[model samples]
Target: MGRLNTLDDWLNYQENLHFQDINLGLERVKKVYQRLFPKGVSFKVISVAGTNGKGSTVAFIGSIYQQSNFKVAQFSSPHILKYNERFVINSVQATDEQICHAFEKIESFRGETSLTYFEFSTLAALIIFELEKVDIAVLEVGLGGRLDSVNMVDNDVSVITNIDIDHVDYLGNTRELIGLEKAGIMRKNTPCICADTNPPASISQYAHQIKAQLEFVREKYASDIGLIGKHQQQNAATAMLAVQKLNKILPVNTIQIKAGIKYAQLDARFQIKTINNKTVILDVAHNAAAVKVLSAELAKQQCSTIAIFSALKDKNISLMINEISMIINQWLLVPLDVNRAINMKALSNEFNLNHNIHVCNDMQNAINRALNDKQYQRVVIFGSFHVVADALKILIPFMKNNEEEIL
Candidate 1:
């Protein structure tokens, strides 16, 4: 880590920079951000926050702007594949040299102030966006919005996809509390759209308190979407509403809006692929809410399915398992090596009563066993981004010659 010359070196150094993995406050980030850009970012920003659908919404908005011939920079969290995936401008990931340079600059300006790994990543994204002089930047909140490093910037618009019971430790257990945390992205007098049909009162209360132009959009987009699941329609509607609110500044026509929503696709969100004569579906349904949606979509497939799953200890594992238990025929429990991942023995015990559960040696073993099982025609890799990332690492190269298609 001598000079942090490479992106990997900088990323590794940042991971050990802060005492905590998620120090959810903006003070340190703001101090460094001010140093990076005293006048703040010149491009328009639309910050998205929610338990789920944040990535999809960001994709929709970014795709719309890109389709409309505008330079769009998108910053998302917890990349499934690589760190570069977190920062995309015009659908291309930021180069290693560019990201490393940004990291070096942030480190120089950071001085004695300590910043979390996410904070450094957020700062780097903003710096890259400013340097690229992008027309707009769509930022996905890493965690709870109020104190999240991304919240330091005053965004032009805010979108809350839906509030659910996740991140209980930090955001609180109730939807009201979580909704309020998600509501923090809203700025005074700026448009904030809540796509949740029945949003918690805390969201409106906070919005009203700040005099934000909060619009509760209950209607789903009435059109076909490239991404599967009924939830995508709602996300599409939310993205559309946000775009409409910015009409005066970033005007996009109906055709562009429709096309963007239709074509917007994110990795591991109900993503489908055909590999080795078997169908594989990958989804990052780590929480119960997302798993519920994944279950509903899974029910449509007539073939018997086997799931390759693992999740973090903090997540509601029982609820997530139960949500999709009915759709998945057999379970291949794979262990993730991450610090927060649940213990394999404990996870296997959760499926004690389920006779179809098979503890695999590793992700590759799980993939092999699932694909080799003749009884199961479909393989589903779901749970956390970690699981999907592992699956992708093995599947991407295997899929090079195979025809892959997204749902």
Candidate 2:
């Protein structure tokens, strides 16, 4: 293959290079990783694994470390806007030149191994982080913890952020079975934080068998987190408890924790934007668990909601729709271009009884309807992350109206 110059070229190469999209295992990636990085990482590693709150927990942890003057590198999956969003060095996304350089180096060493798009991108990010010699590396597990490429490095601190029933295909259907998979990232004698106060018994048994020190979330930090919604408070508490275990190495005061939780901003979580002078919220809540939290938050909103939504075919659509029906006054169902997206007719079956349900061919048309329509009090974009990513383009002209989220 010729040397790739643009970021698009690198992404296209990665997409085409893999035979399968999600090949879950460590040996193939670990073997190539070793060749790319002969000398292992010396920085403190914090690996976060969970069903819903993994991204928020990582954002909180990374922001706190950054505020405390520690050089931090974060590896998160599923970029919302751009591929560079997956790799953050010192709180900033890496430039195209930087990512291309990392890709070039990894390609030079990866001779025989065939890596998936995610695995290859993960290796490239790690190579950059190793070269930067960051003080702390915060890695968010892509899928199941045990076989995830991110789990190849032994983490100093491991956190499981309240596992639910998401990703049933790969991690098993039951919570107990899934908890065991998430617990695979825990190293022997290292501190393991279970953000879920009521995690399955298998997690406890596994941690005990591995001799990993485990801390269950309790009254340790019950105070409200900086973000809105009760679920966010729980996520903040989870990150707070996990950080306490690392206080000796990376000391941060209560003030910093307060600031860090307040400053921790993600792309789609309770993100508010004013589109054409009308307020709208963007939340990526596809699963039943996350939708439940979103519905609870919606109840607190002062006005009626008009939601522009799209969900993947694999999601539990019935539960999500039923949960939101309690608070949503109107629905603007849209279709996404992704392979997994569900069409409007398919989505109609779930909310068939609702009188106010409407449909549009695409996200932009839905946004257009939401902005022009006057019946609903506020517009909410929810369901899958892809819907919110596409909706951002429509809201770009009104970027100044976006509240709390950065550009």
Candidate 3:
């Protein structure tokens, strides 16, 4: 079979998958994955899962492994910019041809077993990792872990980032319930790392049930990261501890860990940039828990904040709004152009806080409004990934133009 040539072709193929809901049973996907790549797989895999921080943790580990002179492949979900961002080999994104070829191979091998878009993509990434002969492969679970296709691979080390109360419909409404779903990635006798300060009881219970050696932050190890917020420091510390334990299992050295910690780059996580003499910070804080962190970060900054916000329909909009309402001098609500996006009217009514909230259907208009306001020193573009992605697309060009003018 020939490979997909264009973006539209790849998208059309993905749309044909026909799997919509979050299926928690892995029998079908497991069958396909096993048939495609037999058990006792080729590459060493590290599976990371949680409500948040999974992508950053995977990036940190992949960076460390690459710095250690090991060929590393990382597969993450919900790309911020491009589809190719999902698969990175040796710190570089896989070429479109590489992804298309892997997808073609998966389509041929997946005979009769129906796979979700995420599942198919996971299989393709694994195929690419195997073909590349990577020394380490870090996979981030797209959703709750047990049924997530990435969990099909027995991980060398399982890292569960901080669990929260998002995805209530599929993962349950409680923190403990969600944590159990996330902990499903842990394997027997493998080292499991949990970054949550007050981890749900089910997480520890599940780790013990699986016979995985549990490593908890502030208990087994600790570190003080120079990151702004407490949550980021906790995430950095958890990743560092995981690397420490992984070093014992793998051939990683201290120098590699140090270099990885120093150079990990993840955009749109409280990222600050100056464009046209205006300070703009972009963060993807879609849920209440994440918004709490954003609230604190904004409080720490030294200027009046003008917020450019958008969120998904499923998010706790009221809770998130309430968390940051006090600090927001002005609110520009932009609608995200995705099915999962929340309507601006619904979000505006949900907020109802005593603040000046303006709805801008166009993202650029919202950004322009925020930047044009010379009164507010800090402009925060936040809420959903779509909102941040759109904002970045505009901001990057604006910044580039300003830089050219200066030169």
Off by over 4 Å in 2: 220-224, 401-407
Best by TM-score: 1
Q: On residues 1-407, what C-alpha lDDT tens digit does candidate 2 reach at each position?
A: 87788999988888889888888999899998777667777788999999988999999888777778778899998998888999998789988888999888878888878888898778877878888888889899999899999999889999999888987888899999999999999999999988886899989999999999988877534554555567777778778877778889988888888788877878788887665557778888879989898888878757867889889988888888888787888888888888788877888887767548888877778888888887776888989889889998777777855544423
Query: TM-score per candidate, in order?
Result: 0.98, 0.95, 0.94
C-alpha lDDT of candidate 1 relative to the true structure: 0.90
Residue 123 lDDT in candidate 1: 93
Give Cα distance to truth, residue 301, candidate 3, Å. 1.9
Q: Which segments of model 1 are wrong by more than 4 Å?
A: 404-407
Spell out the clash pairs found in candidate 2: none
Cα lDDT listed for each candidate: 0.90, 0.84, 0.81
User: Per-residue CA lDDT of candidate 3, range 318-394, in tens?
Assistant: 88888988889899988888878888778888865577989996998998888888888888888888888998888
Worst 10 residues of 1 by lDDT: 398-407
Per-residue lDDT value at 290 in model 3 = 86
Which of candidates 1 and 3 reaches a greater TM-score?
1
Q: Which candidate order results from sorting by TM-score in descending order?
A: 1, 2, 3
